[model samples]
Target: MSDLIELRDRMRAFTEERDWAQFHDPKSLILALVGEVGELAELFQWLPADSAAARVQDEPLRSRVGEEMADVLLYLVRLADVLEIDLGDAAMRKLSGSASRFPPDDVRGQAPEKA
Candidate 1:
């Protein structure tokens, strides 16, 4: 099975074991994901832009950032699982659509326009 499917199964089992399925609805999982992203953002909120990248590469901060990112991924996977969506396939289609919309020859080195 794909890694995403394996992760989804693991997360589902974890939630089931915790009796947390009631709280794993789409809205709740999305909200949890946002909170995790906020936590991840908080790590860089006060950093100097020039040093931000380097700082996250260091000791404790790197681990913290990784944990927060993992949280975000887990919540997102749980959300997709609950919604019966294939996260990887959806991501691939979205990426393919974007590639067609923003051809490299046409949009290279340029920021994408707001829809």
Candidate 2:
């Protein structure tokens, strides 16, 4: 199985073990995801674009950033699991749609048209 699938399964088991499925409805998961994203964003909130990249070189900040990123990913995977969504397939389908909407040759070096 793919790593993401394995990770999703692991997340499912973890949630089941905690009996937390009751708290994992789509709306709650989405809110939790937003919170995680906010935490991740906070890490780079005031940094200049260049400095934001450099900030990851600092071990403590890097660790926090990594944790926040993991939280975001875990919540996303769990949400997908709870919703019975195949994230990999969904991502590919989205990518295909995006490719059709914004063909590389047509959109290269240009901003995408507002949908």
Candidate 3:
């Protein structure tokens, strides 16, 4: 199986072991995912763009950033798993849609449209 599948299975087992599935409904998971993403963003807050990239190469900062990133990914994977969504497939489908919407020739070097 793919590593993401294995990781999702492991997360499922872990949550089941804790009887936490009751707390993992889609809305709650989305909130938790947002919280994790906020934590991850905090690491880069106020840094110049180049400095932010360089910060990840340092010691304690690197480790902390890695932990926050993992938290973000873990929450996202768990959210997808709870919702019975196939993340890899969804990503591929989204990428295909994006490619059609933002044809390279038209969008090359252009800023993304605001949501």
On TM-score, the candidate that comes out on top is: 1
Which one wins by TM-score: 1 or 2? Answer: 1
lDDT of 3 by residue, 1-115 (tens): 9888998999999999999999999999999889988988988888789778887899898999899899888889999998899998898899898898888999899987941
What's the ranking of the predictions by TM-score, best on top?
1, 3, 2
Candidate 2 collision pairs: none
RMSD of each: 1.2, 1.5, 1.4
lDDT of 2 by residue, 55-85 (tens): 7989999899999999999999989998999
| Residue-by-residue lDDT tens digits, candidate 1, 6-115 | 99999999999999999887888889899999999999999999999999999999999999999999999999999999999999999999988998998889999852
Candidate 2 stretches greater than 4 Å from native:
none
TM-score of 1: 0.95
Q: How far is candidate 2 from the true structure (C-alpha RMSD, Å)?
A: 1.5
CA shift of 73, model 3, Å: 1.0
Model 1 RMSD to the real structure?
1.2
51 in model 2: Cα distance from truth in Å? Answer: 2.8
TM-score of 2: 0.91
- In Å, residue 100's CA in model 1 sits off its true spot by 0.3
Top of the candidates by lDDT: 1
What would the TM-scores of all predictions be?
Answer: 0.95, 0.91, 0.92
